[model samples]
Target: MKILTIDTGTTNTRITLWRDGKAVSVAATQVGVRDTAITGSRSKLDEAVRDTIAAALEKGRTTADDVDLVLASGMITSNVGLHEIPHVLAPAGIADLARGMESELLPHIFSKPIWFVPGVRNDVENIGLHNCEEMDMMRGEEVEVMGLIERLSLRGPAMLIMPGSHSKFVCIDENNQITGCVTTLSGELLHIITHNTILADSLDRDFATEINPEMLLAGAELAKRIGLGRACFNVRTLDQFTIYQRNDRANFLLGAVLGADLLTLKNSNAIRMRPGIDVIIAGKPILKQALALLVQNDDYFSGDVTVVPDDLQPQLAGLGAIAVARARKLVTP
Candidate 1:
């Protein structure tokens, strides 16, 4: 089966074509659900998606008729996207995710069927006492996690960490089921603190260049020593003391924020106790910082840490797998 998957996120949209369990073609654009929904008209969003799909089909050398199935995940199913599909509760497996998918015909774009996969939700009960039973929801990362499990042939419990504007830590069991998940606003918070606050003036450096690993590790260690509250202020203090260069300051800031995130995860009772934990860090093009922190803070987790660069294959595999499961009548709606 030829499957096309569209993964729309907060700032970008990606389309990947899959055949026989591999990605044949992939395309990406800056038009995300949030980027196109300025007017609140569903028609406008649909039109944008149609245009992207048209472009992708041309680039992939495949017409609409050539595709057997079209699957969409990420914020595309949000209230601001094409439509809002309610989230499927956690402990979800392929069958649960497949059953939650909603199909619709876009005659304006193609005759082929399009399915929107619903997001996954985990209630507060599974997260432990500090949360007091609040709910967490994710749209795009679940599909990637599912695909990674199958591609990596991971048959045991594993922790999948997807870092982005908002990060997700998903836990899967031996049965290849999502047992629970946690979301952190660390990325967003970092942006706000560095770009929107007065602290921005203290650090002016190009982030595209290679980050200093030493400064990054030092920042992580500093956060661990004094906690984030004081560590955040330490960035400014370093500026006053002229202790670090401009680029070094930026690296320190990155380390401090990532360190705080690691500290929170390390302190979590659920994370500390998970058996035979295998860590997979996906997404985020620059992974040196995250990997360093993970390796440095080995006290919280004792397992192999694998880094998988963010690509189009995992999303394609995930969408295709769910579609196959549905086609075989393995999932109930």
Candidate 2:
């Protein structure tokens, strides 16, 4: 089957052309929902989404009519996206997402109808600012989680740590369903600490090319002990008093930021975390490495931890898009 998968995020748009369940060509652009949010117009996003799909097809030497299916996920299904589709409730899997998938004919974007996968929400009702910490939702990560399950052939319950601008920790059941999720803004906070805080110059306003495990854990332990407020100031002190290099300091800062994220994992009721659930950290190598180390050090979990191979990482969403299509019976097994 020839498939066109589009993934839209806050700062980027990506399209992948797949044939027989393998990505043959891929295209991406910096255009994203940020443009729409900034300008209060979807023209730029619409144009990018439309053009990126066309560009991917062209790169694959095919056209829309030749495609068997087109799938769109992420913020594209939000109100500010191409078409808004309400979120699917949690405890969802490929089958649930398949049932909730909305098909629409948008002539401006594609020749055939595009299947939009709704994101998953923990709970969206009856909130009074109390017991609200358990609520979480995800857009594009649902598809990626499906892809991870499909690719890894996961049968037992597991937790997925996808670190990004907004990190997501997705919980899955033995039945291959997404039971719950926990989100953290560690990435966004890391950005602010590095670029917009007093510690910027201490680390030279850049991320570490190569991080130090020792420094990283030192920061993590410090955050776990004194909390982030003082831990952040520790970055300045480490630079001013200690002889750690720029990369080392950067690792310390990153560790401190992600350490707080680990706290969210321990505190989140939405995650439904249990003992012996395997952990898969999918993202940049440095991040997964750091996160894996932290998870190993903490007493919260006692299961095997694995990092998604870099080569297979990019194909996760596309693999997931195919999984949804298969679940919807849009294609043969």
What TM-scores do the predictions have? 0.84, 0.97
Question: Which residue pairs clash in candidate 2?
Answer: none
Candidate 2: deviation at residue 138, Å? 0.4
Q: Each prediction's Cα RMSD?
A: 3.8, 1.2
**How many angstroms is residue 192 displaced in model 2 relative to the true structure, after the best TM-score fit?**
1.7
- How close to the true structure is residue 136 of candidate 2, measured as C-alpha lDDT? 91
lDDT of 2 by residue, 1-333 (tens): 899999999899999999987899999999988889899999999789889999999999998889998998998888888888888888888888999889999887777999998899896478557768878999999999988887777775888999999999998888878888989898888988999999999989898677688988889889989999899888899899998899999999888989998888877787867767899999998898889988888887899998888887876877887789888998778
Number of the top candidate by lDDT?
Answer: 2
* TM-score, prediction 2: 0.97
Q: What is the lDDT of residue 58 in candidate 2?
A: 94
- Poorly placed runs, candidate 1 (over 4 Å): 35-38, 124-134, 211-213, 267-276, 309-333
